[model samples]
Each structure stands twice: as C-alpha cells, then as structure tokens.
Target: MFPNEWLWRNKLIALLVLVIVIELVLFLVPWERF
Candidate 1:
C-alpha cells in the first residue's frame, strides 16, 4: 500500500517491457553480418 512499493513495481514493469521490445527488434531484424 506504500507509495514507494508502487513506484518500485512500476519500475520493474517498465524494465521488463524494455527488454521484451529489444528482444523483438533483434529477432525481427535480418542482420546476418554480425
């Protein structure tokens, strides 16, 4: 119920979303030159 706890949860969710987006871009891109 604390505000700090709520903020921390939001931060974690944002981090997870960012990671997923990065993974998707990497998978979708066809950069075989690496």
Candidate 2:
C-alpha cells in the first residue's frame, strides 16, 4: 500500500485538537458561581 503522509498528519492534528477542547471544557469551565 502506498504511504499517505498528508492524511496521517491531518488525522493526528484533528485528534490532538479534539482532546485539547474536551479537557478545557471539562476541567477549566466554571458553571456554578457562589
């Protein structure tokens, strides 16, 4: 099979971005104010 460098790079970048977004929303976002 031929190597696909562009596709691999895009997939990895997408995954990294997804993880960063999830972490920010779950750990950094404040919903309750007292």
TM-score of each: 0.83, 0.69
Candidate 2, 1-34: lDDT as tens digits = 6469988998999999999999998887776752
> Which candidate achieves the best TM-score against the true structure?
1
lDDT of 1 by residue, 1-34 (tens): 5799899999999999999999999999999867
Scored by lDDT, the top model is 1
Candidate 1 wrong stretches, greater than 4 Å: none
TM-score: model 1 vs. ground truth: 0.83
Give each model's clash number: 0, 0
Which 10 consecutive positions of candidate 1 have the poorest summed lDDT? 25-34
Off by over 4 Å in 2: 1-3, 30-34
In Å, residue 11's CA in model 1 sits off its true spot by: 0.2
lDDT to native, each model: 0.95, 0.87
